[model samples]
Target: MKDYPQSVRRKDRQETDTSFLHEILDNAVSCSIAIEKEGYPLIHVAFYHFDAANNDIIFHFSKHGHAGDEITDGKKASISIYKYGRLYTAAKAVDFGCEYQSVIIYGTIRIIEGEQERMQAMSDFFDRYFAHIPDSSYEAFTAAQSKPIHVAKLRIEQWFGKEHALPAIATDAFFPAFPSVMQPREA
Candidate 1:
């Protein structure tokens, strides 16, 4: 890898801190994956887990969808995860904005193959979303009855992270309670 790609328009908002990227991923439960098939563009929204240990984006999808067969290694893919923060309103309509933390990863998608790895990924997914279940129940279900699902991992080649925070100086004067002007305001 490369770091940030040339695609992000707002260069000033780009963040390089590894922890910031992890933070965004940690807080997000869903992501939007973009792929191309048959010379057309496609995007899929799915639940995901960010495996920081190996820097992988893990997710499961139905085995019958277009993704099940197309999302294989050596294929280009991109995933975007975001956290919504407070809305940022400016006195000027053109300056209206919002606070957020987001990460976009561009990489190759790999469908996990081995049973053991698939099981481990399943366990991680279960633990992440249903940690309250009794350990015995969880283990038995995963170890014995869990059928193989289509789990895919994206090997990140380049990533981008950006965040928006309201400046401390931002006050009521900057963000009005109502719309700026009923008419156009110069930028």
Candidate 2:
């Protein structure tokens, strides 16, 4: 990873372990990318695959979508992935905070070209989301590739990981568990 100027205010919450960063990237469900388009911020959320081999991130969008229209080749962008945990409550309102782990990647985007590379990139993306399915299922993905989709890769130049967590034991400062799923309401 290229060295970038440190900007995180809380050094205690900053994480430097490469393995931990990789783990978060592998498990994060989705990521948001921020780009500057015509002096305005354009943020797009999408499912992505962390390309460990090339140290890049891969994603796709409809060719007619806003992202496809605004994202030019070699555009500078930042990607963020995060997971939230418990919400900690304190006697002082200012102290209240939530547990979270996140990574922010600064990189440049490239629109992928050529049939073979695009097919492989999309295939890797499919496997990341549906690894349990058999190879035969890939036929469906292959068929879908004919649609008007723009595949792009983010070449990572720098990245930083940060986390804030609470102790396992409960204390006066109560930390409520964050629900992973919402329950259905019953009459």
Q: Which numbered prediction scores highest in lDDT against the true structure?
A: 2
RMSD of 1: 8.0
RMSD of 2: 3.5
Report the CA-based lDDT of candidate 2 relative to the real structure: 0.83
Local error of candidate 1 at 104, Å?
Answer: 0.6
Identify the runs in model 1 with alpha carbons over 4 angstroms from their true place.
1-7, 136-148, 167-187
What number of clashing residue pairs does each candidate have, in the order they appear? 0, 0
Candidate 1 lowest-lDDT run of ten: 168-177
How do the predictions measure up, each by TM-score? 0.79, 0.84
